[model samples]
Structure formats: structure tokens, C-alpha cells
Target: MPGARLTHEDRGRIAAWLADGLGYAEIGRRLGRPTSTISREVARNGAPVAYLADDAQQAAGHRARRRKPRPSATTSDGQPTEVVRGFVDEFATLLAATGLPRMTARVFVCLLTADAAGLTAAELVRRLQVSPASVSKSIGYLEAMALAVRQPAPGGRRERYRIDDDVWLRAWQADTGAHREIAVAAQRGIKIFGAGTTAGTRLGRMGQFFARLSEQMGGSTLAEPVGYDALTVLAALVHAGRPLTLDTLATALDWPRDRLTAALDAIQLHPAIADPLVLRTTEPETYTITTRPDRLGPAQRQALEDPGHVR
Candidate 1:
């Protein structure tokens, strides 16, 4: 039984050991399997964070039963043979770290390693030797994540799945809206629970985090400024008693997102003009003016107007 496949119980022990934060060497000592075996098993299943003993064991069995002769795939170094297998294993492992299912990662790697035209479902099924259902499910999941795209086969009705240069970028862009939604929901929750309460306070903090995150997304894309909109926004915030969300500020001031942002940018650049302004407090991402009034001298205060009105 030197090279025998691992038993189900063995896998359970592996999972427990992993949960206990044991390294592969320690787990291998406990399981009496080579360290390489345990490492490869986890890599092909779902890496450490998402690995489930039962699922990994099942996948291992499926792969074992489906094993076939290797193709003429070459390594990145151009050596012929199955050296690309190791790269595929590593790629699948890293993909799982990003929250992709192991099966989905495997299927994605298969397409990535395919010819320029990509592969049909039938081809994926054949290449991975997984069930047609498995290929279909993986394709669907990748499609939903924007990590893969599907198109018609060149001369056939069958659809082909492929990943392109911007697959990851598109996936990141897709989540930017989700970040905006989270910030909005959290901001709304602040008033409902009353910011003085613990729940309201937590919501406010969360609102700030998501708001900053959403605003900083590269895909959010900043806009050019047009007029003295920033001055109006400052006046509105200074007049309002409590902190306000960007959305609320935009509506109350009747300024567009870009203009509001530009105004805030202007105020930030000239803190003396709006030295009392604070973007975050107990309520995150919400804007409020300081309760204490003007520390700025007449000259500094006069300079404030010049910076307050953004170009």
C-alpha cells in the first residue's frame, strides 16, 4: 500500500490538522503519507482555506478514475511533455485562493491552456475528464463572476468558453457597484438605529469603510469639474446640523456626483477655508462641520472663499 490512494478517514484527519494550523509536513507525519501527496491533494481540491475533506476525497476519486494518457502539452520553457501539468496545478491552487471553486478553477485553467479559439464544453469535458455536468456548472460559475466569456463555436452551434486578458479586471469592476451598494445601505442604517446606539455606531463605521472603498475603486473613475459647485456643497454641509451621506448631500445641494466630489476636493486642498469640515467621525463616510466655530483669522477666512469655489 506504499502508493495507495488516501482513505476518507485520512482526509478527515488532514482537514482537522489543517484547521488546527498544522503544516503539510506535520500533517504528512500524522497521515503517514508523503508530504508531496498531501500538498498535491489539497492543491487539486481547493487549497487550504476552502478545502473540505469529503469534497476533496470525492474529487480525487473522480480524477483517479478518469486518468488518461497526457497530451503533448509543454512547459512555459518550451520543453515538450506534461510539464504544464505542474503549472496547471499551481494555477488552480491560486485561483481557489481567490474564492473560485476547485472544479471551476480546473476548468478555467483548461481553457486558459487551450488554443486561441478556446474550448467547447465537450472539449473541456474531454480534456479534464470530468462529467459534462461538471464542465457546465464550472462554465456557468465563471460566467457569473465575469472571469470567463462564452461565444459560438467557429463553424458549429456549440458554445466555447474562454478567459481573456481583462477577465480579472472585469471581475473587479463588477464588484465596484456592490461596494457602492454596501456603503449606501450602511449609511441608511445609521439613522434607523440612531447613531448614539451601538448598532447605529457600528453601521456608521461600516458605511465609512465601504464608502471609502467604493470611492477609491479604479473603475469608479473621477470626473472633471465645471463650476463653483464645491462652495455650494460646503455651505450645505456647514448649514446641516448632522453628518450627511454623499447621496443626501448631492440631493440636498442639487449637485451631481462629480461636482460634489470636486467641491470636497477643493475644501480638502484648502483646509483653512473649511477647517471645521470633518469627513468622518462616529459616523463614517458622512460629512459634518465642527461644532466649534471659526479659529481662522480674517485673512485666512478670506482665502477660504477662493479655495471654496472649485473651478
Candidate 2:
């Protein structure tokens, strides 16, 4: 079974079990589920004093809506799989191993799996079936780790939090930064602990290693392609003198169609493209890089490469 569905009736039974002062394991025996599952279910949705069946059902419904899409199963397999939920459960378990609070880990994991591309603090509370205070604390913890970021909602909408492409990269950077700071502190500790002592010698070694690590990371370059790769494609398109179609662009780049589409979308967002390469057709979607160099100036082309200069 993928999982047993908890009905309003089941919630009432759970309440009765609690009233009888039965432990979660005993309750699970009666309910035919794992004790840990029952404990998590009640702890997440039940009230402080009681598990109101109606309220619990409502909360569960909301949570179900927020979950990642489930895969279909058939008689051929003879087993149903809630792969998304399984992955999320494993992710939560991994976070718990890292010493993160279970509730905090679950909340952040939900954000990672959400399909809306982002969520606000309020949405997180609704989706996680958690308290506002709990959601706020979880968000603060994630932000401190640099695992999440806040962004303005599109078209002057509410402030929202999102997991972007740079989210994991920034988190790694923050972790390294912490190590660098600790190294500096260790050096100071060596002086305080007395340079003649064994403890001082160990601390000094730690300081040296981290200082070297920090330097190496600083000098290392990311594998990101320079604007030259993108410019090369644009340069060829300009010389070809015909509106470049999406299919042609994909073939020329020798990359997947989805990747090419993403690139095209990013390029279309560029103000330089908006001014110089007007969309001639969108169905067989084609773009022409205007030959008028004066109109599409070098400054504008450079601006397209710099996101900071997206005026």
C-alpha cells in the first residue's frame, strides 16, 4: 500500500485512544499503521488537548493539496508508489540526522518540493498545517543557513519566499564562510590557550588548514560559461540575415530543446533583444537581429550580458 488514508472516523478513534491514555505505539497497533506515522500525524495536526476529527480532516485536505504530484500505479506493478512523498520523507530523515529540528526540516523540505516556484510565510503555514509562529521560526532558521531567499511577488504582488537556482550555491558559500570565521576564532584561541601547550598546537593546525581552504575556494572559478558562448550564437544569427527559429537554434546549439527554450526565454527578457530584435512571428516563433548597428549599440549588447544592467 502507498499509505492508508485517515478518515474522520480514524481521527475520532485516535482521540478515543488518547482519552484512554494509550501510547502512540498501542494506538498504531489498533489502527494498523507504524507508530512513528501515527505520532507524526497527530503531533502535526492534533490540538494541544484533543484531536478534533473535523479539524484534523480539514487540515489533512489542505496538506494533500500542497503535496507534490503522485505517480500512477497499475496492476502490472502490483504495488503503489508515492515516490514524491517517499523522497520528501527521506529528505526529512536526512535533515534530522544533521541535528535540525524535525518540524523545521519538514517545513523547508515542503518548500523544496512545492510546485508554485515559491511560497510566502502564510502559505507555508497553510500548506504545512503548522502554526504561524512555527512557520516564522522555521523560515528564520532556513534563511540563516542561506537555504531560502525572499523575493518580491511579480506585478507588485505580496512579498514571497522562493528557492532559486542559486539557493544551494549560496548555502554552500555560507557554510564555507562559517568555516573561515571559525578558523579565525581558532587562531585567537591558540593565543589565549598558550602557544606552548598541546591544545594550542592543535588549534594552530586547524587555523592553518581553514585559512588555506578559504584561499583555495576564493581563487577557484565557477564553471559557468562566459557571455561569449551566448554571444557566439547571436553573432551567427546576425550574420545569417534570417529570423532564427527555435528549432534551428536548438539544432545549432546541439543542446536539448527544453534547455534551448529556457535560454531563449532568458534572452527574450533582455531589454536589448526587446529593442533590437523585434518578434517577427511567435507561432513558428522567429527573431531577427536588426543589422542597424547604430540602433542595437555595443553598450546595449553588453548590458544584455549583465543582469545588473537590465535597465
Residue 210 error, candidate 1, Å: 1.3
How do the predictions measure up, each by TM-score? 0.50, 0.44
Alpha-carbon lDDT, every model: 0.70, 0.66
Collision pairs in model 1: 230-263
lDDT of 2 by residue, 60-150 (tens): 9999899998667422224333454455556876886798766567667867876555877777665544567766787788888888777
Clashes of each: 1, 0
- lDDT: worst 10-residue window of model 2: 218-227
What TM-score does prediction 2 earn?
Answer: 0.44
What is the model-wide C-alpha lDDT for candidate 1? 0.70
Q: How far out, in Å, is residue 271 in model 1?
A: 16
lDDT of 1 by residue, 1-311 (tens): 11236778888888888888999977865553457778887898887988898998788788878998666775334765345545665688788788777667878887788767788898776555556877788899989888889999888899888888887768777787688799899878988989899999899778867755654563233233422555566678767877888889988877778777777775554443443444433465467766323345567656766876434
